[model samples]
Target: MHFQFDDRLNSFRQEVRDFVAANLPAHIVNRQRHKSFAPDDLHTAEWQAILHKNGWSVPGWPLEYGGTGWSPLQQFVFNDECAAADAPVFPWGPRDMVGPIIYTFGSDYLKETFLPMIREGRHYWCQGFSEPGSGSDLASLRTTAVRQGDSYIVNGQKIWTSGAAVAKWGFFLVKTDTSGKPQQGISFLIIDMSTPGISVRPIQQMDGDDHLCEVFLDNVAVPVEHLVGEEGKGWTYAKDLLDHERTGSSYIFWNKRELAKAREIASSETIDGIAVIDSEPFRSRLARIEAQLTALEWSVLRMLADEQTPWHPSALASCLKVRGAQLQQSITDLQMQAMGRKSLRFIAPQQMADFPVSTLWPDYLVGKTSVALITRAATIYGGTLQIQRTIIAKMAFGV
Candidate 1:
């Protein structure tokens, strides 16, 4: 909760900063500066390998399973430092979302087989939670998996599956029983993406990227051993997973880093013979956003500390989720506004090196427009604003 760090924490932060500076690849830093969603598979694997070598791959996990074994404050400091250095975080599904589930509730076989692969970055994983009809109402999903001899026949479609096209595995929510309530009948399974009858259709975006996909499983055989925990217990496990995810969703570190970049871009670019940041109206907006972001960052520190706070963790997490997503959208809008007409003109990857070399826009503006458009959905993913409102109404207000 303190604004300034103590000696030990400050040293740890410096260590993380030095690691990022010395080890993070140049290509990854460039892609992140331009707001590319993530580094490509090769770069990510290389980065993860370096983290694994140093026992920094999964900071949130138990130490035995390749976690950093850092205190909560250390974890927060690490993320803050990484984002400050423009370093990419490890992929979520393998490191944050599912790895904990396996270590906490999975069989010995599951942990031995998958945790090592995830630690080594040998496979990419995706979530199969949402469907065409089921958006935030994931409990009402219609995808079904029938248990057979040694495997389960999975048949259904999942939309908005991030990284599904390239992910080698997926953790899915499926209707494994129909006689009971919808939430009670659900099960979680890790499906091999290479299985027969499994198909991925990339969802092209305005950003000239295909990070999302529609995954169809038509009678795809998933081994029963891949099921996590127990039958019909996935809803419970999913609740745990979502809690981990939404807690991380505050994204204060990311917002803080990106806000600093926005400040840089505004001060560097000029409009009508004046620096964009010199405008009073723009400063007013930036000032307000900066204040709110500072408050959000403090709230994150408070939650991470796990000390007694006036607000409950669940309610505070929902609050963070709401503000963080909104702040992301605001920052991107500011970036697009700072660039003005230059944001409108775009160039291909190859042309990026030479195009607009002598302009105020600079190369960073190349992907700013696409990032702005895509971030409009920031409030919708993970959990929508409506869902967070529902959670806060229940937990914070007890209405």
Candidate 2:
């Protein structure tokens, strides 16, 4: 767990930086800078295609499955550098979440059908886990899937489904048998978004974007083959998928990049004729956040290096998620503070083109307000702050 830099790692980092600088389209980067959640579908696909061509699309997966066969440290460096370079955040549902579940537990037919599309950026995917009342208590999901010979007829609703509007497919959690325990009866099923009985309705957000959506399925027939692994074992696969990218729950790369942006804003922004960074109050706040960020990064690196911890792996992941969600809010808060009055000038996504660009309203300040607004839900989504703390208490301390 030593924090020393290795020459090999440093060189690898430089290599990734060079690749992104040479290959990443400037227009996409510009659009990404203004986006608070994720890049638009076109830019995301274009960027993913470029990465796939260079064999860097899925760096953490196994070599045979179109991965780079990179060690955990190498994967960490790759993500860190990419975030710093403002690479479009590729859809994680396809590459990180469902892709792994399919490859690891899915049948050969499933792998042949989905993995190539995911790696090549030919399809976009979304998770259908959280429903109206089941956001945090995922085990209580009531979506039902009844077997009908070769297919399962699914009928339910999923809320807060990110990117569902643009997604071509979705992996959902459904109750296959209510006779057993809620957790025991749950099953995982992949459904085509274009299915006859499926509908996606975008939910308007305070940020003026419809990145989140409500998905409804009425008698949506999903192929039996689409069920991942075995029946009534979906709860297990879902947990594995959640824990697959454990360190990602920390959001270290994103926090680091946003922190750097916060510093840039502070250096340029003025508070009563003094640069924000020069103010004692602002400097102290920035320093404290930097220290916390450093500690968080070290903790993630220790986990990547397989350093043992007293807590269970699930509890550790929950701990990281709690801290990372806080930092997301804090870093954005600092940016909003740095912008001061400028942050108050709200610009909807549709008005960006019409919005005038001037010294008073620079590109950097364009999405700061919107991003800050959306980040308020960081602690609520994935898992609520209260739920994560309860998890840590139950699993880590056995309270």
Candidate 3:
């Protein structure tokens, strides 16, 4: 297969770059450039509406379901440009996760009601799969949804839900039967975030951002129609959603851009009367990271090229997740190290206005320390590094 972007794909990429250059808000672009994401509800809505209007909201999906129906390679090209431009991260629940599930399994009525909302940014989604005790071993999730007449009463807690605090809806996996195997008794259901008996509480992270939440379902009632597919088949559907999630979790573009920034910092600064870029050790590190990034780009392209195959091992998906997470943290660590004592000043949100670094460095470096600290969690979310290693062992090694 060809590795080069076709003329059509290149044109699309250029269009995306131009659009982002012209329309992306300064605040959002600054956050992205600085590796900080503070998503305002109204601002995010406006951004997504612009994307939807331009038909760039759903590049990876089928054309019939509001997607652009671009080739996989085109999707890659578009996302690369968006990331480089520091465009708002797509609300993955709609564009990447639940939308696909709905189109693939939900009834026509469900699709008709949800797909348009998803495409138009009228609805936001959160994945309710991992419970307090069930993360890597997702099959152990204990959330229960017992059928009662035409509805199912869900009862349990979901932890680390990324956007539950602001989501309009949540698609969840609940135990419908305990008599069967752990993986067999599950069913996927969509619950409105405003439903009675549902509670959402934010969890403050180390970076001082409440980006994740704990969701409590205390007898929350959901209509039977919210069920996406056949009962007791959520395990299969969850796997599909996760496969989609893992593929994107590589975050290659973000990492590459950060690496470039690191090199720029190195070239601009001097240590002991020598530029960091001229130092042999720092130069060697840059070479290594650049080589790895190059390899990862090609690996992602290979995955897209092989999308026609069924039951592909997804070895590269796991490999890239592991490597990318590690490299992301590594690059941030190097940046912190390069900054020396300049990284020590941790500015809280309240103190951002008076921050001294504003005079010393560009606005993009204001939150560098915080961003580096948060990258520590990259390997844990989207499935832990250990779990990804286990997948690699089984899929790549035939163990």
Candidate 4:
């Protein structure tokens, strides 16, 4: 398989880099560079608007749907350059996860109503799949949507919903029927977050951020027209979304950027007057991580190129998720090690602007500790490492 970028791709990469350099805001870049958490809703919307103005907002969608019509390779290059430039990670629920499903399977009315808002950044979306007891076992979700003529009354709770507090809309999986199997009774529904009886409460994290939320729906009424595809077909739609999400779980771009930061820290931070990176053991660990990252990147590229693979798509995605989650934790652990005691300083997100800066503790150290603390969940979320291993085993061995 060809690993090198051709002349056209190289040119495209430079073009993206130049655009980001010219137009990406300095303040946003600063926050993204030092902060491990995603940008707030305002910044996310603003960045999406900027990309929309440049006609680069949704590069992976069909050309007719405000997409750039770029090839998969081009999309990869765009994402890599944006991540390298410290671009705010756009909210995936709208742009990546649910948007494609809407365009691909939704009614023409649904498309007309939501697609434009999504592209223009006029609305933000959150996924409402995980319930109180149903996360990895998504088909067992207990949320119910009872049809009531023109609308459906949705009643249940969704936990670990990212950005629900600020999201304008949510795509939820609810049981429209229960007589059939757990997976067969589900239906996909789009609900307005501001709808009465819908309450969102943020769940505080060790990192001191409340990006994750619990959404409680108490007899929330959602228009019947908001349903995506057909009833009893939500499981099918959800699988499509989950596949996209699992592929992204590899977190290649984030890994590359954080690994570079780890290297920078190792170079500057000292151990008995010698740079941490200069030590043999630490250097070896860093080299190993870099090599693993290279392999991960190649695996993602192979998937993008649609190369033949012996493993099923599900198994392949599980393998990538397992390794990618491992690398995230390892890289962050190395960063914490390099920072040593300075990593102990805990600065809350709200205090970042007013906190006094020290020459001994530079701005680069702002989010190091927090990131390391939160990355502990890397393997747990997006399906646990154990679960991924089971999937791989089942697919590979039929056991």
- Give the Cα RMSD of candidate 2: 1.2
Q: Candidates' TM-scores?
A: 0.95, 0.98, 0.92, 0.97
In order of TM-score, best first, we have 2, 4, 1, 3
What global local distance difference test value does model 1 have?
A: 0.83
**Clash list (residue pairs), candidate 3:** none
> How many steric overlaps are in each model, in order?
0, 0, 0, 0
* Residue 372 lDDT in candidate 1: 72
Q: What is the Å distance of residue 310 in model 1 from its true position?
A: 5.0
Worst 10 residues of 3 by lDDT: 31-40
Please, what are the lDDT tens digits per residue for candidate 3 over residues 201-267?
9998887677689999999999999999999999999888767875587788778778877877777
Model 1 segments more than 4 A misplaced: 347-361
Please give the TM-score that candidate 4 achieves against the real structure. 0.97
Better of 1 and 4 by TM-score: 4
lDDT of 4 by residue, 1-399 (tens): 559889999999999999999999998887665565744677677888999999999888898999998988899999999988888877788888888999999999999999999998887788888888898788899999999999999989999988898888999999999998899999999999999999999999999888899999999999999999999999999889867775587989989988998998898899889999999989999999999999999999988888887888888889899999999899999998898888888888777755566778777778888888888888987788988899999997787
The digit string of per-residue lDDT tens for model 1 on 319-349 reads: 9899999999998888877776777875543
Best-fitting candidate, scored by lDDT: 2
Better of 1 and 4 by lDDT: 4
User: Can you tell me which runs of candidate 2 are displaced by over 4 Å?
Assistant: none
